[model samples]
Target: MKVESAIAQRISRDALISILLYVAPIALMFTTFYLTGYKPWQGSNELPFKAPGFLEDVFRNLSSWGLAAIVLGVGVIEFAVGLYENKWTKNERTLDIVCFVVPKLVVKPFVAYFGLQLMPYLLPAAKNIFEWVPFWWAFLIIAVADDLTQYWYHRIHHQLPWLWRFHRTHHSAPYMGMAMAGRQNIIYTIFFSQTYLTVALTYLGLGYAALFVKVVKSLITTGAHSSIPWDKPFYEIKWLNPIGWVLERLISTPATHYAHHADTADDGIGNYKGNFGNMFFVWDLIFGTGIITRKYPTSFGIKHYQEEEWYAQFLWPVFKSKKEGSELAANGPMVGDAVPETETVTLKQETANVAVA
Candidate 1:
């Protein structure tokens, strides 16, 4: 019995060490950022990066509609390729359109107005405190803070059963495209923590820089969700392998993001539990939640989904699923451990798949 106890202790120690290995990169990133005095939550003493007057004017004139145009253009290309013709179901289409329209037209404007109103009251003297930070520095700070906060928000929704319902609509589609990226519950969109963070940063006088960051972020995220696999050629060419490696690590590509939308991870290329990064894949890398395979998943979406009504999927809690036993059902258990059973089974099955690969 004593020998068995010692063996168990050794195993536990080894497991803990293994976990730390995965987490070390994330810890290092946070440490480096903090040490560099790039705190997004605090005011900086350095002068902000000055841009050419014309360039600043261009950014200042950019509107939210411009960002929408970029996303819409991508959607048009996807449609031209008939990407969604056969893949998207009626329910998926409804959820995607409703989720896409409602957030941009109503929820986001409401949230932004509320945030703008509440900011001065909450932090009256703190307004424009970060105006002294340089443009490049402020951009770096906003990019990281905005994306990192979103990474956690997305990861947490997947990790917790109750929160999973709020995000389920996103993964319900069996295929991915730019449209699928907007397929989220209304509550999820409205309560997105990063939105408020972005609003606060804008209030701190980083509005122009924040606008630029938002546009860049939108491009990265939309491209990542695209079915085009634009990064595929980079992975295939021997000469571009180094660039591909760096690119994949730096931002979300179709391969990594599709893994997050994969139906199951048993295939070795699918990792629905990880790769929660939106614009930046670095967060996933740092937090030990990323899986990189320069390869896309063969299948996407949650397994055994009962195809709940679009309304229930879009406006859940306000409109519960009528389907019995569904997570979004009126009387269903919210925080139950039942969901992980499938994940456990998938992991066990993945061992054989990995060996075969």
Candidate 2:
């Protein structure tokens, strides 16, 4: 239980910058509404676009069952192509399976059911309030609100000390693929604010837009986490470089996101400390938290990873890791930032160091 680096001791100036980034979403939402001359409270809204009834059903399905099937389907393809190689051990498989299944089958449904039941009481007059907003505007607003909210949520966990372990399971994977795309700690999955935000938007009559946003976000993030590097074509093909420039900046690409999972940030291309964007890479760019090297890292996961038990990785603090000297163990350091090779200190010099990484 001897603590070396105390992450709680300090918050970097960059983290404070991240805090300021929260205003971006709020400003974007208001600006969009102002320019569009639309206000949900004014109540003279009109449906922006009318689609075939079948298309509505299709959108609904894609947002719901289609997303799960797509993740599983792409995952199977990744497995068959040896994208995981020998990295997905039994422990890794258990954690990935549980994370993928439990959240979709159990936690999300529970949250939706309860959230719907509580909505009437929570915001009695707010149900279907924004239903009249144009489809495109609603989509634009929801995209910024959900993604930016999640950007800060994600960035905070990495920069903050006490919250790192909750998100550490995600970084523990040694390789990238759909198999580990949904891998997350139970608590982290349970309290994810993005889910609640989406649900609230759906209840506020933006269900159609929310559904579309959800599908698009899921595909981008899933693809970003995939091992295939499908985006390379955009970078490699001379004709597509223009599109690639905008595309990579606009959304999470494998090149950018994989660098975020890299085991070491010392490499110019690897940036485990930044690249916190999920669906959109623009947030990283706006907040100065992203690096685009157009290169992939050689390795992934935490430098101090101890191969903690799957159960502990999935449900830590409730089930502590049995591995001694492990971060998830009953008594271990709150934030175990890896010491740089060049970092040296005399034993006599004692001071609290923040785990900035």
lDDT tens readout by residue for model 2, 1-357: 223133333235445765556565557667878998767556623345665676555435532443334334444554454335456788888888888778766677666556656778889998777777766767777787788778877887787668888899999999898878888999988888766776677667776677678778888998899888999999999999999999999999999999999988788988887899999999788768899999999999886788899999999989999898788999877763343222325222333334332
Candidate 1 regions with alpha-carbon error over 4 angstroms: 1-86, 333-357
Clashes of 1: 4
In terms of lDDT, the poorest run of 10 residues in model 2 is: 1-10
Tens-digit lDDT track of model 1 for 36-155: 866654544322566576655543432323223323443455344433535667877777778766776566555555666678888899877766665665677677767766876787
Error of 2 at 307 (Å): 1.2
lDDT of each: 0.72, 0.76
Task: Give candidate 2 misplaced runs (Cα > 4 Å).
Answer: 1-86, 336-357
TM-score: model 1 vs. ground truth: 0.74
